[model samples]
Target: MDQFLHDHPITPRTDAEKQGVVNRLKRIEGQVRGIQKMVEEDRYCVDILVQISAINAALKKVGFQVAERHVKHCVSHAVKSGEGEASIDELMEVLKRLSK
Candidate 1:
């Protein structure tokens, strides 16, 4: 998925909350660069693969965080507006795609 996939219903995050995730992502970005460097340096294949797995896990965690927020806020609001079934079905379809 693209960075900043959706214009989400982002509540004003506390400074700490904002910084925590940002720091994590910055670290992930650095790790990505490190992977590139490793490949350029002709590092061990298995080592590079391990870093790739770590990056994938980090990205999945971020996706889960966004999914949780959407369920709590966007889905909540949609359900409140009497469009719950449709909204839920849409969410389910998206989840199904993600699961794949």
Candidate 2:
């Protein structure tokens, strides 16, 4: 697995972007905790499923946002630096998984 993975270096995001992602994750964490509490309190099955669906959607939204940033910054850098093929392959691999 390690052999197949590239050690792609990261470019740091602006402070506001970092903070926004963190804030979104924290809200997702809170939502998860709320779901846990609902389970402990014997919440209805459909209600739990609805919250689960919401969590999945929230996570995917975050994923897409990060992907957009990667394409804009990292992929663009790779293409300019002449490593475009490898970088694009890596992105496509992750995208295939995301689609599933």
TM per model? 0.77, 0.89
Q: What is the per-residue lDDT of model 1 for residues 1-100, given as tens digits with 9 covering 90 to 100?
A: 1123245452445688668778889989999999999999999999999999999899778767767877887678777767678668878988887676
Q: Give the range where candidate 1 is weakest over 10 consecutive residues by summed lDDT.
A: 1-10
lDDT score at residue 49, model 2, on the 0-100 scale: 96
Highest lDDT: which candidate? 2
Overall lDDT per candidate, in order of appearance: 0.78, 0.86
Give the local distance difference test score of model 2: 0.86
The C-alpha stretches of model 1 lying farther than 4 A from their native spots are: 1-6, 10-16
